[model samples]
Target: MDVDTRHWIGGRRVANADTFEDVSPLDGEVIAVVSRGGTAEVDAAVAAAKDAFVGWSRTSPAERAELLRRVAAGIEARIEDLAQVETRDNGSLLRSHRRGVMPRVAMNIRFFADHLSSLVHSDFDTRGHRNHVTWDPAGVTAIVTPWNAPLMLATWRIGPALAAGNTVVAKPPEWAPLTASLFADIAHEAGLPAGVFNVVQGLGNEAGAPLVAHPDVRRICFTGSVPTSIKVGESAARNVTPVSFELGGKSPLLVFDDADLDLAVDLAVEQFDNSGQVCLAAVRMLVQDGIYDEFRARFLERAATLVQGDSRDEGVDLGPLVSKSHFERVDGFVKRAVAGGAEVILGGGPNDELNVATGGFYYRPTVFEGVDRTMEITCQEVFGPVLTLQGFSTEDDGIAMANDTDYGLAATIVTGSQERAERVASAVRAGTVWVNCFFVRDLSAPFGGSGRSGIGREGGTWSFDFYCDVKNSVFAPKGWN
Candidate 1:
């Protein structure tokens, strides 16, 4: 297949000899071809960012915030176009991406922009003392985003970094570079300085590693898998460069005996939104034995009711996996779970009925029954719309089971008692615990994982602290000195 080599560099589309194909998962069709960048592309992007950083980082915070506001406007203006492209590119349901994801992300950008405009730096009132603490830019950041929710997560990192006066050489996943390019274009149109935000498109081994390890690159903000995050950590360690990783999760949903079974079932189904591709999605559903069967039956009924169809189709609740490899991996996990003796309580296997003429990569929304905490299906971050339902004998057992995973990204607890919700939420051992909902994220909330899930937070005002550094100066006043 002939591939197009259009790479986003310094806010413009450039071409090169190398290329990669953008394949559609809806029918395994070649949608477009993207440039496969290499060391040269990485070096160019970094050099541009480094050259621009001196001036861009020195820009007034209000000016930076204004630029972000314009970018947000640009995004809103092209929301439909972006939503359609994202749906076609990633197999995300168009309605969900438009109604749920894009609007939320755009709102986040505006929220942060307004916050940045209103921000006032600390004042030193130490009786004429020169000693004070100051926050400073960390230079250029390498913002690497995953293929899943490419634009939203990228802006989550880039927005704060820019707001903190850090220029960026952003690199989207080669497999999904168009959205990154679109964002960069929007930023440029918003009157951002030339070279302030550079984007590179290429594979991880070639473009991504070099960008992370580049001496001029100050901090690396990455959102991807835990294993890949470790590799990034290794590279960052070698250079002593700071890194903030938003990685994997096997998040759990714990339903207490006194919980509203109907609402629990509703929230449990929400866990599978976006086909459970989110890193913070609740993949494990743990119910107290008293209500396990009831919750299980309700949850499966809800799951079965999901309308699996093309993303562009109206009223389609689910869509195909992001790619062929993703489909295969998800299929493998479901098959392996059955092989490992977990019973399929509801929908399982592939869905050819949704798009019979088209070879859509659709996996049936699956639920595994009789799952134990130690089972692979329960412990692994499957990253699919597959939930493993397990029953716990006691509240303590439920909490223990929820916390048993290596991940501590997010967890959900369903209970009517405020005290029980608070206690269980606190004891769940996850970074963010939803008392009665699942995946309710906000701009002001600090979002990140603990343990093996991830390294740093990515939202709210707290995220700004992650992209910059603070220096404390201790000294007496001139008279005292």
Candidate 2:
């Protein structure tokens, strides 16, 4: 695919001295040559954004919302093409992109656009004083997005920043950098002001570090793994910039003895979505002892039937890992787990059988049965199509086991009783909890993580709160109106 994978600054593509090949996970071939950004590129993008922030920050909420609406329209108008590219770029299911993700990307922007103008900013009287709260737009924001679900995640941060009237410089993951350039083109065509939205593509240390640590960057948003988040946090700390992170997860999926067996089994299988690359998927399952054997039997039967192949195939259920290195990392984790006394109940590893037939990083859906919280596989985020099973006896045991992990991003509870669902959902220390369901999201609800999983929330008013400065102006009550 011929794409302009260059740094976008001030509404134009900026050329670079160094370049990197963007490999397609679909077939392990070079799809595009992306311009590699360095500190210089980051500096240029930041300068552009800082210059644009003056006018953007001064714009009325209505005007910013209208522009965001246009950006949403532009994205939807070319949703098919966007989905196709994302599939080839990220090695995810095209059907999923066409049906769900791409639509949500546009909606992510549209929701913020429509709601920013109707925000609940009100003035109230207290002690003969009328006080009005204001959401003031921050200056330039640095957004570093991950390779998995790049477009969706980037827009999740970008939409709110733009709607809040903050100019942005996004450093997209070099592994899946194509669509970010495409997104920049759409924004420019939608008539977004120059430098309001910029894309700088390169290695983390070279480009990402400079962008996040830039003194002029007022806000930083990062979404990636735990180790990488530490680096980002350190860089942002130097500038004392406010940052928000959506990091790794070892989230738990709980099944009570009284849970509907069919529902529990189905939800357990859904964890393999995106080849278990999803951060929000609860891959570590803690099941009640009474129904443990039955759940395992049903889960194994369904998991074995999952067809792994190239993502371009229409009926294929699983796709390759995002890259060669990621596949090795996941495979190594499985091997180590098996050696450490965890029994592989199902798939152990791919023997390169699928990759032999087709070129790419392919692994079978794997499950380990004899898993314990003491094991690294149970505690660490493998970020693969690997599930670890551990049986718990009582409700307290299940909750304790679920909360054992250092990460608290998301969790799932599958149960028959409403009381149990409500109780467990409340007790679980996660940013988002689903009862008898998975991946069902409402845009208005607050979405973020706790502990090592992340720092702040970014949905609806939570997003505005992150990208804006909340202030109150006091006035004389009688003369204010």
Give the best candidate by TM-score. Answer: 2
> Candidate 2 — which pairs collide?
none
lDDT string, candidate 2, 116-213, tens digits: 86677778988988899999988999999999899999999999999998999999888898888889988998999998999999999889988888
The CA lDDT of each predicted structure is 0.81, 0.91
Q: How accurate is candidate 1 locally (lDDT)?
A: 0.81
CA-only RMSD, every prediction: 2.4, 1.3
Positional deviation of 353 in candidate 2, in angstroms? 1.1
Q: After superposition, how far is residue 325 of candidate 2 from its true place, in Å?
A: 0.6
Worst 10 residues of 1 by lDDT: 1-10
Report the Cα lDDT for candidate 2.
0.91
Best by lDDT: 2
